[model samples]
Target: MNANIIIECKDLGKQYKTPEGERVIIERMDLAVKENEFVVLFGPGQCGKTTMIRLLSGLEQPDRGAVRINGKRIQGPGPDRGVVYQTISLFPWLTVMGNVEYGPKVRGIAKKERREKAQHYIELVGLKGFENTYPVKLSGGMKQRVGIARAYCNEPVVMFMDEPFGALDAQTRYLMQEELAQIWEKEQRTVIFVTNNIEEALYLADRIIVMRNCPSSIKREYEIDLPRPRNYVDPEFLRLRKEITGIMDKTL
Candidate 1:
């Protein structure tokens, strides 16, 4: 691995047994993500994007290859990798502060210390006034903000986001994308984001890796050199979007 590479997988493969037959989801896929780089995995639905995140984050093991982070092979989930999901899995019973502080509190940090750390992240995610609010009280976008804060509070070196904004209304999704991009610009981390939205990918990614349909592998890679806070209608943006979409395998 290159010295700058923070996470990498080599010759990765995965499959599953089903009543119909064995199904392959990923095959001979290899990727390396550099430190503090925002890389987006863009693909059609059911393209194993989530599985790739799980494999890289150590939530699941690859059947035929290995994932390494900072020169160490990953065995399982660790504090070094954080995940935010589309479902916004915040503890419903826990307040925003409680949810954000959960990781540090479980790791045995002092209450005052963890609370301070959690407060910083809450404010960072633009939820300062909602610290005492529960998940049920949050809007869809706010709940995802809490999820992002909770993940960031862990101070993970890498963050794997599996379609974190996919469930939001279109207007809200666009808002969250801008907010997330701003947040990332303020506090950079190695981010591996999964999404099927071409505009979202172009807006947030330093590089976008397009994936093939099920039994997925990299179909193409685009280095997005466009300026931050990207214009959705920019000529280059539309050109790349159209080009990428043109090559994608259509879903049924």
Candidate 2:
């Protein structure tokens, strides 16, 4: 593993036994994510993007090859990696504060220290006044905010997000994108986010890895050099979007 590369996927592959036959998802996928770099895995539906994230984050084992972080092979989930899901999986029984502080609490941090840390993240994710509110009472966007806060509360070395805003309304999705950009700016962490949305990938990723359909592998990689708080209407953004979409279509 390269010292500066925080995450490494070396010829990683995965397959599953289905009634039809053995199903392959990823095959010999090799990639590296640098420290504090926000990388997005973007591709069309059924492209094994989520499966790739699972393998990268140690949620599931790859059939072949290796995944390494910080020069050590990833055997399983650890405190160094945090995941945020598409469904905003917050505990309905726990209030906003409870959810955000859960990780630290379980890690056995002192209550006062954890509470202070959770409160900071709660405010960071814009949930200051709603600490007592449970997931059942919050809106879709707000629930995702709690999910983000919870993920960050652990202070992981890298964050894995799988289409986190996929369930939100269009307006809310855009808003969350901007908010996430701001949050990343404020607290830098290496993030590997999976999405099928080109605009979202363009807006968030320092580098975008476009994947192909099942039996997935990298189709192309784009380095997004746009300024922070990117504009969807900007000419450069639209041009790159069109170019990437055309490439994706060709890949399909």
Candidate 3:
């Protein structure tokens, strides 16, 4: 059976008026994400990958075109679309359990039920014992785990991630990537991940969409067939990476 189509973007565009006047950031872009699909939108900095995610999440409206989630047009942020940012946006005053329960609470889940949901995800992300710990005390990777738990606590239909591991050091970032992959494998939620790292994209994406520089548009779409726990140095992997790098070079 085909995975359900969760998101669709048709001729999406965004423009901003700056000191230099109207600037086009995205144009004539169309994309789709299927249920439980892991997709990476990668390109150079300022390539509008983040902008595209925002549009899909309904954080920002496009100047033209439309974005729909589950066949309904998206207009604003809602529980159906969960977002995790580069910075750990957890409430410092809240314990791990409290932070995770925040969403369900606001959505009117009873205290006992919300707490149960929170605890489940906390354990799912390997933070079971840290339920009472504060965000300030957790390591970078652990904090991101908390963020992921919080996002998933709501059982969102689609998760939008904007460089969720970008702020960590190399080793921690790699570990987090693997951890995220593990989580995705089990839950299988639709995911649209935005990053500038080609290797990161290759490692996590079921399909990789490369965007061009400013006046950003989809340049290429490559379906990665490499097996999981991929070796970046494998011949096929290196070939695809080099080919993507060459295309990215021309856009610069």
Local distance difference test scores for all models = 0.94, 0.92, 0.89
lDDT of 2 by residue, 42-145 (tens): 98898898898889889899999989998889989998899999898787899999999999999999999999999999999999899999889999999999
Residues 1-252 of candidate 3: C-alpha lDDT, one tens digit per residue: 234788998899999999999999997788888988899998898788888888889999999999888888988888999999999888999999999999999999999999998998999899988999998899989989999999999889899999999999999998888888888888788999999888889889999999989899999999998998777689988898889888883435
In candidate 2, stretches whose alpha carbon ends up further than 4 angstroms from where it belongs are 249-252
**Model 2: lDDT of residue 177:** 98
TM-score of each: 0.98, 0.97, 0.96
Regions of candidate 1 where Cα sits further than 4 Å from its true position:
none
Q: Would you list the rank order by lDDT, best first?
A: 1, 2, 3
The digit string of per-residue lDDT tens for model 1 on 1-252 reads 589999988899999889999899997688999999999999999999999998999989899999999989999999989999999788899999999999999999999999999999999999989999999999999999999999999999899999999999999999999999999999999999999999999999999999999989999999999998899999999999999999988764
Clash pairs, model 1 backbone: none
Specify the poorest-scoring 10-residue window by lDDT in model 2. Answer: 243-252
lDDT, model 2: 0.92
